[model samples]
Target: MTKTLTIRRPDDWHLHLRDGDMLRAVLPHTSRDFARAIIMPNLVPPVVTGDDARAYRDRIMAALPADHDFTPLMTLYLTENTDPDDVAAAHADGLIAAVKLYPAGATTNSASGVTDFTRVAPVLERMAQIGLPLCTHGEVTDPEIDIFDREAVFIDRVLDPMRRNHPGLRVVMEHITTSNAVDYVKAHDTGLAATITTHHLVINRNHILAGGIRPHYYCLPVAKRETHRLALRAAATSGDPRFFLGTDSAPHTDANKLLPCGCAGCFTAPNTLPILAEVFEQENALDRLEGFTSLNGPAFYGLPANDATLTLVRETPEIPAQIDTPEGPVTVFDPGMPLNWTV
Candidate 1:
């Protein structure tokens, strides 16, 4: 067995570092391994403009530890009223890396998301012209759609048509959770890709509901069946440039998560690297781990891979069950098995 593995430092293609105290506490976890991350824009008020994105980036920089060399790549939250000019200007100025599309009410703090796709057509057109990418929470929010079926339905009903309309637009189906998503991205030749989260690869729907309600495993575009989890594992380890790491390591205080109507997210930032190493090892695809976690994301985003490298030794370490923050305690995702790798 390969005992020690060294690869280019990875970048998290998608991440959520919430504001204020939460941000301060969680930022270090991600900075520890990832060289940079595409920061999510779905805060309470939401980051809908170049100015909002810039301010958020500044806050992230402020919260970052002085010794860390991590960069927070900003993104704008697309709204029905999003100005095409502002988006173009932000991308041109390098203030924002991409624009995030959250269908209104799709997930936490998504009330300000786009309710009318047509209203944002001009913005999408401008993005295509500028070669800016659109990162999406790819699920339809219709009340009638079975929660489990939303992702597949979104592809057939929303994503496919939108892609056909804007052939030049680059889109990332963020934190994709199903085989349908896997097949869809594979079938599309270019201008389309998907990010698979670390938590999704480890847990299936059963982990959330089988024995008892496990709030820590609950997240939007929730974990799918065992078969879907297997598919995601296969795609992520397949060495496909279109599939890459995006931890989507959202943090919610224990109070909020264990409530009657708990928030949706898994705080996986702290342990993602070790868990990933273990998963890749078990799949007997350790050779492809570098591409999946480190190389593929940068290749898809047209950015240079990190010059630095991270070394993971095959040594077991005990992972803490939870991390305490000023706001409250946040649970760490337990992969339900001991991890034998450490970075």
Candidate 2:
């Protein structure tokens, strides 16, 4: 077996580095491995304008360790009030990489997200003209729709029609979690792609509900059945350029996560590469790991792959159960098996 592997330093196409203390605590884990990350804009008060994005980028730079070479690719949270002119200017200045679409109440800190897609049509049109991709949460917030079915339903109701209306617009169905989503991406084949999360690839609904309720294993667009997890593995490891790594490594403190109505997210940044290496190795697709982790994300976002490389040694280092931050302790995702790779 191949014991050690080296590949171009990876980029996380989707990441949530919450500002202030949480940002300081978690940024190092991502920066240590990733060269760049598409920073999520769903802050407590979302990053909605060019000014907000620039300010957030500055804060990220300041927070980054002096020795690390990492870039924060900022994004704007699309809302009914989003300004097309500002988005264009940000992209033109290379301050932002994409616009994120979160259907109102869709996920964490998404109360300010878009409710009426039609209201944002002009903004989408402007993005299409300038070639800015729309990264979407890909789930509906309808109380009636079962949580497990939201992603598949969003494809039929919201995403498909939007693509049809603006054929030139590029869309990334972020952290998709179903076979239905996989089929949609394969069928579209152009100007559209999907990001598979590291946690989703490792866990399914069973991991969340089986034996007992595991809060650390829960995440939005919550993990589906075993069959869906298999599909995600196939898409991610298949060497298909449309699918790539986006470790939606959202972090919530243990206090919040253990509450009656806990937050949804898996804090996977600390152990993402090791877990991915184990998964790809198990699937006998180690050769394609670099493409999914390093190449595909940049290809979709129109950026160059990192010139630097990361080497993963075949050694099982003990992963900490949780990481400490000023806010509180945040639990690391338990992959439920021994990981034999470490970066």
Candidate 3:
């Protein structure tokens, strides 16, 4: 057996560290394993402006542990009324790494997202001109569309046309869950990429719907059929630069997740590295693990890979069933299988 493996420290291309007590409680889990992360901007009010992103970044820094060596690469949430010039300036000053696009009502805290895509054409054009990447939620909120089909439909109705209109715009299809998404990304040689999450690789729709309703297994861009899970695993382990790791480790308190209409997310931050190592080892592609979790993301974002290294030993890890927070207990994602790697 391959006993131990070391690679450059990974970066999360997509992450959600909710503000306040939740932020303080969860920030350490990610910083412990990752050297940096692209912090999601979908707070209740949303980080809409340069000032908002700056303030949010400051708060993230304040919440980070003093001894942890980690950086929060911030992003701004896109709204129809967003100021293109402000976004450009934020990138110029290195205040933000990217801009997030959430179609209104697509996911949690997304009410402030863009409802009218046309209204943001100017912003997209400006982003393309400056080579700023647009990280997208990749779902359409149309009530008529089947929930399982939202991602594929969004590509046809929203993403494709947007890309067609702004040829130079760089886009990251964050937390993609469908093979259609994989094909779309493959068709485009450049200016397009996709982020696959840890939970998605291990679970499918059955994990959430079978036997009983497993709330902890539920998440936005909900897991699809088994075939799609296989596709994601293939893409992530393929050593393809166009696909990379983005845990999308959204945390919701157990109270919030068990309600009649529970929130959608999987709190995978605590054990992502171990779970990823297990997945990569199973695929017999341990060689590509570094590219997925560490190198590809930085290259896609035009940043340098981390100099620090993380070593994973082949041993089972003790993962908590739940983590405590001020509001309530938040369940850590259970990969539902034994993980034999620990960092």
Which one wins on lDDT? 3
**Clashing pairs in model 1, backbone N/Cα/C closer than 3 A:** none
Each model's lDDT comes to 0.93, 0.95, 0.96
Where does candidate 2 stray beyond 4 Å? Answer: none
Over 4 Å off, model 3: none
Clashing pairs in 2: none
Model 1 gets an lDDT of 0.93
lDDT (tens digit, per residue) of candidate 1 on 105-147? 9999999988889999999999999999999999999999999
Cα miss at 245, model 2 (Å)?
Answer: 0.6
lDDT (10s digit) by residue, model 3, range 157-183: 999999999999999999999999999
The global Cα lDDT (0 to 1) of model 2 is: 0.95
TM-score to native of every candidate shown:
0.99, 0.99, 0.99
Candidate 2, residues 9-82, lDDT tens digits: the string is 99999999999999999999899889999999999899999999999999999999999999999999999999
TM-score of 1: 0.99
How many clashes does each candidate structure show, in the order listed? 0, 0, 0
